[model samples]
Target: MARKAQTPDIGPFDRHSISLRVDHVRQLFQTLDPYPFTERDLDKDAEEFIVSWARELTGDGPIRIVIHLPAQEASSAEGRKLGNAVRRYFEERTRAVSLDLRECFRLGRLSLAIGASVLALCMLGAQALSQHSFPGSLQSFLTESLIILGWVANWRPMEILLYDWWPIARHRNLLRRLSVADVRIVAVSPDERSHPPH
Candidate 1:
């Protein structure tokens, strides 16, 4: 299948708000050192910043920060002023990070349910085709193809669910562990071409 580039359905937020948030985050990140930050530092900094900034913006209640970053160069003094305002907002915020685990889990569960439904539909179609007195070879081919398609379809939703459950910090750790396991498996494989030399 030719994969179409999906235009993301951004919820509720307007371009201005998103731009503001991006500008804020960029300025916040700039306060830290270097690009391509490691997992540990990124996790720690993200948590600390989110918590502090949230508290400052919303004052001990649920808060969302909306930042705007213009695509064009900020040549005008007004643009620079707006950027500086975002920077100050981050600096003045509280220094705590908290995530609602329950909400994250709920989102994960919803994603899993959707993926399972898609897989279930694929299975049902295969079963229906099999019972229609089709030739044995054709039935087998259709069933196998449907199963493979279903598996591929489910992959992205499953990944999203996993990401929600793990969050950034935990996800990074999970990826590291998975990478190590992959390396070990490749090292132990006898066929260099089949498994490829690690």
Candidate 2:
């Protein structure tokens, strides 16, 4: 297996390289996909491995993906299309994640509207109860319950707006970076390809 490339200092920004070794370029793509090479999805394990490594990467450095394949396979027509296939896969993922983020925000907005309306009604109910004559303990309990229920109604919207969207947005950004990442294929000896580094 080819060793990971050392960090590059070509420009002001850093360059990070993520490397992997496989017996053939085809191993990097989903075998079940009937689409042509450039439009095919990446293999699930391969995609997960690449994305996990990307998430661990730091800095605003440019990203590159290096795939090591057997010399014979590396020089083949399929290998020539590997980079484009990888880019297209990630581009599709980026678009899908963008949709997820948009849907998340839409749900958040709708929930917020519902939550606010419920809260307003609850507050009004509590305020009306406060002015009515009732047993002291019962009145206190009802008022407190209304207030608590009102806040509870807002829980989903607050969670969606404040916390849930972050990871989705971050994932979308990650996929976008990977979609444009430079991809390089390195030729390796058959022996090295057979026993790829762990």
Candidate 3:
């Protein structure tokens, strides 16, 4: 029977490590970024991979990123700066996510105000119609419709406050964790496969 492959343990209970292997350090970053290496954004695939692994490794202690590369490339100047680059990228991402979260909350607040106003107007209209003593059937229908519309008007605000912001907050927290994670570069032989250690 074949055995399932397992991820090699990276460290003790306190420190967790995320490992990545690439042929060149450039593969870790965007190809067309106009900024210097240290300020460049990480490539989409690389960022997603690192973030996914980071999420799985559990700990309150510091996390580590180990980048494995060929001995030659690993020893190059780019490798020396790889740690800083990765850290900077995550820091920027953290800030960006923070802004997105703030905007989400702002929108939620505004929507809530609008929704409340609408609900109040609906309730007032329903109350006014009740005092008119229209035909019994017509009055019931109008009152029920206004109440339903009022609640429906609040749907967006409720959704934003309860559901939409949660994922954004979680993403921001993950980016914050990654921003402060410790990064390391490891040299590997040319013959070694660019795969995480098993």
Residue-wise lDDT of candidate 3 within 41-108, one digit each (tens)? 99998998888877787765677777777888888999898888898889999999999999999999
Q: How accurate is candidate 3 locally (lDDT)?
A: 0.82
Query: What does candidate 1 score on TM?
Result: 0.33
lDDT by residue (tens digit), candidate 2, 74-139: 889999888888999999999999999999999999999999999999999999999997875999
Cα lDDT tens digits, model 1, 43-107, are 34443544433323322222223323333323334334443443333333211111344556566
> Which regions in candidate 2 have their CA more than 4 angstroms from the true location?
1-15, 191-198
Cα-based RMSD of candidate 2: 2.8
Greater TM-score among 1 and 3 belongs to 3
What number of clashing residue pairs does each candidate have, in the order they appear?
8, 0, 0
- lDDT of each candidate versus the true structure: 0.41, 0.84, 0.82
Candidate 2 C-alpha error for residue 30, in Å: 1.4
- Overlapping backbone residue pairs in candidate 3 total 0
Q: What's the lDDT for candidate 2?
A: 0.84
RMSD per model, one decimal: 22.1, 2.8, 3.9
Off by over 4 Å in 3: 1-10, 13-15, 191-197
